[model samples]
Target chain A: MKTDMSIRMRTMLYGLMCVLLIPFVFPTWWMVTSSVKPISDIFAFPPDLLPRTYDWSTYQRVFELQPFAQQYWNSGYIALLVTAGTMIVSSLAGYAFARIRFPGADAIFMVVLLGLLIPAEVTIVPLFQMFNQWGMINTHWPLILVPVFGAPSVFSTFIMRQFFIALPIELEEAARVDGLGRFTIFRKIALPLAKPALSAVAIFTFLHSWNLFLEPIVFISTPQMFTLPQALTQFTDAYGGAMWNIQLAAATLTALPVLIVFIVAQKQFVEGLAHTGLKG
Target chain B: MANVTLSQIKKQYGNTPVIHGVDIEAADGEFVVLVGPSGCGKSTLLRMIAGLETISSGTLKIGDRIVNDLDPKDRDIAMVFQNYALYPHMTVETNMGFSLEHRGGTKTEIAERVKWAAEILDLSNLLKRYPRQLSGGQRQRVAMGRAIVRDPQVFLFDEPLSNLDAKLRVAMRAEIKNLHRKLKTTTIYVTHDQVEAMTMADKIVVMNAGEVSQVGAPLDLYDRPANRFVAGFIGSPSMNFIDGVVENGRFTAPGIDLETPSFTAGETSRQLICGIRPEHLVIGGEGISAEVSLVEPMGSETQVTFSLPEGTIVGVFRDRIAAKPGDILTLGVQTDGCHFFDPLTDLRVE
Candidate 1:
């Protein structure tokens, strides 16, 4: 039944795809190769595909600049906390909005969705003031609490609500007949079936928190508290002139963990977004 | 096992009423069927009895206690949904034992009960598989097994076999009937297929437009429907209706005249509908003549559609009818099978 293409046609198609992959793949390749190239050869005319000379010192200089290890750990743990916290808060809120019937539910949902329309730039001042009053101005609390409970989670809640709405109501009804309370039904029945949606939300929240730049720059000041994105900008000379090779090495380190996470979970990430369920 | 009684039970969504006040009774250990066309509120009524839907007014009693406001789990009634509704992630054994686990049954007790239900349903080998891995009929059996594992006071099925193919449906139908016979548990099953109702029910409740049209034994309802709806709804191919008037001990229409049954002798010159089943039309006898419009043959019988000046009618005959379209066939009415309905009220004229 499959109408497979001729070998020659397939070969040509693959060749075309390889050519098209250049713009996306070349930048990362350049960043990696340029990190080990001498500073003079980084912008050499007719750029070298492979480094003619290796300066392995740039990788070590990346750690020597700022508290790079500390920043890396901060970004890692903050993203982990944000992903976990967002999943719980959004799933509970989503299940309630999707299943529970109450007065003013639609009105409340509309208000929550309004959070999505407002950009983080608009609320940064009031948020900074609020965190300053709580003595959390230079701490990681603002980074963790804002994304988990604030505007960023609204989108995750929307995705979870949509997934729950598409679920069959008969399953819940059958659980009720089986002597389960509302919370028990949600835990034993609904939550387990919502794995795909939850993974999708986790990936989105983790990536968003990992690459966060503006929030760290605005709220954090000391080098020990700096996240990776903010620390990547800190690799500069005393005159504030950018350290080209060291910064590229640091950027490569920042991009490595996320690339590995994506490659490992890409299957679930795609399936989660498509919202396929276990058929019965 | 227990008896279920509905006393003027009603349901409405906000301002619009769907199920008008309905009253039905299923005696202890009885197998009752609620059969109707789609959107006839049959499933709604069954859900109300299952305690899934709140009663707007009146009382519902399962055995001796009023269950109108009780939660579905507290009512001790188990329900099988149309789609099976098996927890897709759980294995069949865990699905069958889920309710017992929630009820704080010991692990050994839960396992034993699940094993017994699985053995009864022929699902012992499939216990390790998830619902998605099983076939449709197997999933249906697991759903039934999940219900039977509870051993509740009452069993409710909402179009449980409607998702199967024709052959599997018939097989499951017989299996369900046999299960009912063995358990003798009070059961309320809702389906739109009248064949399931006719073949499986000890008592059939025929509903139309959210109201009970007739409630009786299978043959009793087929032999004597309470009104036009019941008469048409109960039988396959439906009953044929000929609008006519009784005059001079005969029924007369535009192109037909036939002798009236003895029951209609006193009601002379009255307008009514003559109801006859297809199997009741005798092929060769002294009766009104009709032109054969279409003829279809099964291995056992031939179904012939006849066109008269008044309207068209169908007849099923055991004889292999050789006549094709445009052929004229003489039709005779069996007087004993004749039913009279008042045309204005659409009610049987006793």
Candidate 2:
């Protein structure tokens, strides 16, 4: 009963799961294989899964076409800054919303939640004008500042608030009896136990900042100041046609590191996200 | 250790009142337990004393200071929560010593204190383990260890043993009572379990519907409950209440008549709620005739449920009853052991 049923069930389940995985797996497969294919074979009548002639030149052209290294650094540092900044700002606000009882706290939280409804796309035009007026149009300030203080961080704050709300109130009460102030309790007790939520928030915030497209194109004009997303778009012909090989190659470089990291720590990444009270 | 006084303590949420001007005073080193059914304001009163809840419109004095506005940190009290509330991230040692570290105690001092508490709780070997690794009983001991390490002015417990299994709760109850005896710290405990209040408290405060019904020793409240609420709430299986009328110095109901030397004027014509504790009813007494409905043998004592003239009543007896359901039996209510209360005010008339 056990062995025959197990064999049949296992094969059927594996087949179904693999079939369901096609959409997600295919895009990544296409991106990696096309990045390494010769320019002609990329659009051949029969698409080549393995390039007949490897075009290593596209990878070299990816770096040479623009200040891709500097743009990579721009994306890297801005993501780090946004992650760190969001962790601090959202955690403090989230703790207050969850644990503190200041006057009009619910009203203040509702006003903060208004940030989530006003998408960055809706506010981009005015934000561009505002940053341009401040002579900050070409810098990374808007990309970093807007996420840390605006809509993206609100979601992080919401995740963190939900997590903190689930924490046993007794721990804080015990801390109070132990003579720790509100800030001390938050720093020592609440934040340390909130590592799962913090990691989840960091993953989300970093990804959001790294993939910013419309904001970078609207705010940045200089190639030297361009982020990776803007730089990926720059890998095109002078007539504005996409150099698909070079773009794909650069996209591989831009996306591979995070993919590899996520794959390696997939257990933590998935579990951390699940523990943030987001899933049913 | 210091005396804690709550004067006209009231708790109201917006316009709705929860605790309505209840007063209680705990002498230095006294063990007080606030007990009642759920939503009876017992836990709320304890939280107010702990400074976790605002005292709405009352003055709370710990020792000599008016602590209405004081922060919980400034109130100098330790609390043991029902869930044990040990820091899940910290080891038992760190969980115990964390407060001392924040209070600017030296590493040596914190270590010494943690060592002392661990030894007292027999947690020395388990100090390095986190809270999640500990069993429920171990976590309860660790919670008590955290409370005692500080030696705070008052110790507050909110149903600290309710989460433990029945056997473990009994062991922890004795441990807590012994610990209170040794430390002699002013302690206020809250529980919905009557047994915990009866076993552990020097004074038991019985509350109902946001009001203090009675405050006395465990035996005092058990022997002489001030009102119908107290009489019914203070004992196991609860005191069986039978509605009856008072006339000719005897309370008469549907099927039974009980004598009450304590029934007074203005209560003669009024309907009264007559109460009889299960233990006070004598089985096989040839008094009031009853039919045995069920018999539950609890090793040393047997609990017999019988249908009286008024309603089904339960009686606990030390003697084993070989009676079966539908067996005709006679029972007697020891009038002295019974309590009487006016149904209108629900207050004791005797």
Best by DockQ: 1
Q: What does candidate 1's lDDT look like per residue over A169-259, in tens digits?
A: 9999999999999999999999999998998889889999999988999999999999999999888899999889899999999999999
lDDT of 1 by residue, B1-350 (tens): 89999999888999988888899999999999999999989999999999899999989999999999899999999999999999998999999999999999999999999999999999999999999999989999999999999999999999999999999999999989988988888999999999999999999999888888889999999999999999999887889999988877787786677887655466548888989899899887656688999999987999899998988998998999989899877778876777889888999976
How high is the TM-score of chain B in model 2? 0.96
Specify the CAPRI tier of model 2: medium
Off by over 4 Å in 1: A1-9, A276-280, B264-266
Report the CAPRI category for model 1: high
lDDT of 2 at B229: 91
Instruction: Tell how far residue A150 is off in model 2, in angstroms.
Output: 2.6
Per residue, candidate 2 scores C-alpha lDDT tens digits across B1-350 of 99999999999998999999999999999999999999999998998888888988988999999999998888889999999889899999998988888778899999999999889889999999998899999999999999898889899999999998999999999999989988999999999999999999999999999999999999999998999999988898789888878876777776676666776544547577878899999975534678899999999999999897657988999998899999988777875876878778989876
Query: Candidate 1 chain A, which ten residues in sequence have the lowest lDDT sum?
Result: A271-280
- CA lDDT of every candidate: 0.92, 0.88
